[model samples]
Target chain A: AQTVTQSQPEMSVQEAETVTLSCTYDTSESNYYLFWYKQPPSRQMILVIRQEAYKQQNATENRFSVNFQKAAKSFSLKISDSQLGDTAMYFCAFPSGGSNYKLTFGKGTLLTVNP
Target chain B: DAGITQSPRYKITETGRQVTLMCHQTWSHSYMFWYRQDLGHGLRLIYYSAAADITDKGEVPDGYVVSRSKTENFPLTLESATRSQTSVYFCASSEAQMNTEAFFGQGTRLTVV
Candidate 1:
């Protein structure tokens, strides 16, 4: 079974500063998909960004971007100019990728953006 | 109003009791999923449905039951609740196409005592 791992359980950054959350996965397939999801303290979850393994270029969404290293099996999320609203639990996910497109998520990293 | 939603945002039940979690999506997506979120285990899949009358078990489907007679409704049931089954449950839906984006609903925090 494939698994996603987020090493940092908690992280923090000052408002307007930048922060990076680390994630890794174990997969043998050359082409796949990876994703970053944010769950606000209010409990509403949203998709931050997604990356396709087949693409060499990384994916970026506004102030959010991903550092995807296909070889190292690492996919890290970088938040630039973080806002107080950015304080939430971020999760990394991967698709099962065969017949079932089920998503397997990692233990989230709690992020706090100080004002 | 046109998105996925889960009922009983918070639930408390006793062991050996049967409880059901309701998930409804307005999108009528072809795929719907039920996942349980735990402290260290992340979100483990409990069950999924490809369409009405098409359901499949996921990684953690042992104590849970699911049915999808309608494309817009997918309900998860716990035949016999246990303390270990207490966790935040999330319901998500996506299009039939692979690699498409999946949207999640506000989770249901279930507590079994």
Candidate 2:
């Protein structure tokens, strides 16, 4: 079984600043995928970024990036130039490759971008 | 619109009543998933289907049932609603390609009183 952990329950960042949300997971499988999803008050789950366990380079998408450390079993999300729209509940998820396509998600980190 | 959609955006049901949540996708994805979102728990997978007529249980499968009679539709049913079953449910679909992203629906908010 794979478990994702997000130590921070809540986080706040000033507008135009940068913020990093921490995530760690436990999985015995060597091949897998890590993802960060954002859910706003609208209750829609949106994919932020994704990282392949085999890739050494981190994944970056616009202002969102991931620091994927396969050895440490850590995958953190960094939001640069944070804006009010970035204020949402961020969740770290793990999807096991192979026969299982189910996703294991962390509790989530509520991020508030204050102006 | 090449996306997934969930019906009955909001539902209210009494205890012991049967309720069904509908999920449909236009992408013709090979995989469909059902998940529940709660306050403390971010998201938990309830059930998933690889293709039509092939379904599997996920982390939290109790008190819930799902079926994929068609390629684009996956419906989740609560045989007997309970207060503990009150939560937001989300439907997602993904292709068979490796590392493919899963598209999510707006979600359905269910309240069992």
Which candidate has the top score in TM-score?
A: 2
What is the DockQ score of candidate 1, to 2 decimals? Answer: 0.67
Worst lDDT run of 10 residues, candidate 2 chain A, spans A95-104
Give model 2's DockQ, 2 decimals.
0.70
**Per-residue alpha-carbon lDDT of candidate 2 for residues B31-104, written as tens digits (9 for 90 to 100):** 99999999888899999999999999998999999999999999999999999999999999998655777889
- Interface root-mean-square deviation for each candidate? 1.5, 1.5
Estimate every model's Cα lDDT from 0 to 1: 0.91, 0.93
What digit string (tens of lDDT, one per residue) describes model 2 on residues A1-115?
8899999999999999999999999999988889899998888889899898998999999999999989899999999999999999999988876877677789999999999
Q: Which residue pairs clash within candidate 1?
A: none
Regions of model 1 farther than 4 Å from truth: none
Off by over 4 Å in 2: none
- In Å, residue B12's CA in model 2 sits off its true spot by 0.6
Q: How do all models score by TM-score?
A: 0.95, 0.97
Question: Which ten contiguous residues of candidate 1 chain A have the minimum total lDDT?
Answer: A95-104
Model 2 TM-score on a 0 to 1 scale: 0.97
